[model samples]
Target: MIEVEGVKIDTRHWIGGERVASTRSFPDISPIDERHLGDLDAAGAAEVDQAVTAARAAFPAWAALGPTGRGAILRRVADGIDERREDLARVETRDNGSLLRSHRRGVMPRVAMNFRFFADYAEKLAHPGMEVRGHRERITYDPAGVTAIITPWNAPLMLATWRIGPALAAGNTVVLKPPEWAPLTASLLADIAHEAGLPAGVLNVVQGTGAEAGAPLTRHPGINRLSFTGSVPTAGVIAAAAAPNVVPLSFELGGKSPLLIFADADLDLAVDLAVEQFDNAGQVCLGAFRLLVQEPIAEEFTARVVERARALVQGDPRDERTDVSALISRPHFERVRGFVDRALADGARALLGGGPNTSLNGLYYSPTILADARPGSEILTEEVFGPVLTVQTFADEDEGVRMANETRFGLAATLVTGSAEKAERVSEKLSAGTVWVNCFFVRDLGAPFGGNGKSGIGREGGTYSFDFYCDVKNTVFSPAGWRES
Candidate 1:
């Protein structure tokens, strides 16, 4: 609640075992109202160096806690997140225009699992022994050094935990750069982490803009690994930043995710899935925004989806009955609207509600359905992160898969098929990090979530999550070394 210049910036910086601040700052605006959220001090180069230095310094002591002890702390944090689930959801809703009910019902459960699943697997994460045929040495996994975790604002706390929980559990110290828009949830987690008994510098939270805080954190020589969750373009910057050090980066980037619907698919079930794609107004990087249906069912499915869209009620996220809320800000709303306008210009007809809801001062964009969007139109190809959806028909299964992979992104994909063989076939051809057959957005913390190709590098969630957040060192031992011991 640290508001400056009529803007509320959560200036709470967790560094060197304490929460403090930096001397320099910048303005933060709430997207919901274009109101000044606050002025935030950009963590300067020196602060970045100090934070990374602190992580470097803390790594030895923190990692020395060993697997079991580290797991205990993460597990405790998971329990704490559960205990404060309601508060976290409310804060997240306020900070980023997320649906409170979705956060509580859909997200918190995953957050809890993300912590515990990784914690449970922490001890087992360390390598056993691996040998290559004709090789004289045994290889073991070891933590490289301090990690930088840069996350987007869409699902701030959840994404942050997805990185931090595993990084700490795997015996790596962290420098977490949460999106400036939603720093409060990270701050809250920091407090809970300290109470959960994690060491001071083992988990550090730095609040600042991407250029000021994020770039420096990624480029810092002290950082050995980087895990980022954001857009592809932004992730490109991170990749470039990490390049100088040849630092390994795990990116959970953009998605123009396609939902392939077979003609035989259930129309009722398909419409239900359509709303999930527009979840949180479709701000999700993994949002299933592209709905690619087979030709036979396209017209009916499109109409039914449009009907469902019209039925949606946009209002305050806190309202239990509201099905859709506003986009994150006016800019986002404008961007979404712009995409819709372009679609219509390209001959796509709006079969459902399209445009801003003037009735609501909040960043409300009505759920829109564009029928017959040109194959390469911006709405069809680009990630229109709003309540807008594009419905395109493919003649057959192969064509559906082709249309689905038309974008530069391959983040997440969903396929609905009655035949298991069809799903299996489609799953193989689908180029995404996560493929939910007959489903979408069902997450198990132990399962890996990420994308392929330009969608961004690496994966998140599960035991392997720590791998991206951590650089692995090979500890090779020969018979001679064993003899020496």
Candidate 2:
């Protein structure tokens, strides 16, 4: 156990509202300093089954509580999260090496906001209005049974709750398989849920590798729905595993999002948005990886972005001044490094940082920017998922839209233009789930969020979330009973 903000957090599988020991365990290491934090119990098939069984048993009573009752408990969960904001942020920083300041200022608060928003949303805006002229029609949402949720490591707690809040608010019991790389916060979340009086079996967390824990959870017949946020390969594996059960799946997969900058746009704002890609050391899935700058401003904008990338401080995540920190693990660091190395080898020029930061230990890669990267090159087309951005120039509006849309992934994009007409016209053509105009990472919980193409299979947030968590049914009555009673 590790102590965070006076709370001793146990790194164990939380199933049926209790900590469960496993025959096999894995070491939880801090990416910040490479310290062995604790031995986390790795849940196997048996544990997955146990968690699923518990969720199934709790489904009826949990659903019976209905929206209002469930929302009340979720509100308390949000309060508990808010109360332990410092603790959660600290743990997350140590666990994944995200900057402590970012977590405390934004990530942790957003985690609580997710629960609070969904609780209120499920309580209020879940009903779909329908009108039928010839018959009386009513639509109702019924909670899907046990839901299996697999979250990514980059932003573990926040993403987990993004799925969890809705699943619970929709009155469905959940069995969550957190990414083994950063599983601590998920365990702590279970504690908060229990303290907030969330019933046993209503929320269960099983921690382990994707093959061991995640596969079992996805394949479990007890699960009625599955939601996953991670890589495309992992999603593919999950799909094949869940196909036998034919489990309805909602996937928020990878992205090669583009940041389109026009000449008329605010230069500083465009540079800031470009630099924003390096936030969280560029592990953000929705981050703009490919930068398509209009030719008129390409040279100046690239210079500003390169300068900012060079200035970003890299060191311990606990330091408030630090901008970049360690990658999640050695393998991931190598993966990102490989992407940059290959690009440079293939004649792409590194405008700035191109390798690991020798000044600091561990897996800290310098914020990298590549220029002259060939269009459709691996670095430009693939989801590097690092603090690496590739610069590409577009001659005109049509060219900018073309470059942005020419990708297999369509998760998100950013358009920096002063012209409202250009924003409106270009945004419509961008093949992405969400587009940010003159801003980046600003989110409204009410907006529909997901991706098109290889990015994701379905949307989440607002009614979109409810649509997946609940089985919507329409009840239609024959027109006024032709034979009077």
lDDT of each residue in 35-109, candidate 2, tens digit only: 887788889999999999999889999999999999999999999999999999998898898999999999999
lDDT of each: 0.78, 0.91
Misplaced by over 4 Å in model 1 are 1-10, 31-38, 126-128, 131-137, 470-485
The model with the greatest lDDT is 2
Clashing pairs in 1: 7-36, 7-37, 7-38, 8-37, 8-38, 24-41, 25-40, 25-41, 26-40, 31-329
In terms of lDDT, the poorest run of 10 residues in model 2 is 125-134
lDDT, candidate 1, 153-232, per-residue tens:
88888888777777877788999888877666787788778888878888888888888888788888888888888877
> What does the lDDT read for residue 118 in candidate 2?
92
Residue 248 in model 1: lDDT = 83
Model 1, global lDDT? 0.78
**lDDT of candidate 1 at residue 331, scale 0 to 100:** 65
Q: List the residue pairs that clash in candidate 2.
A: none
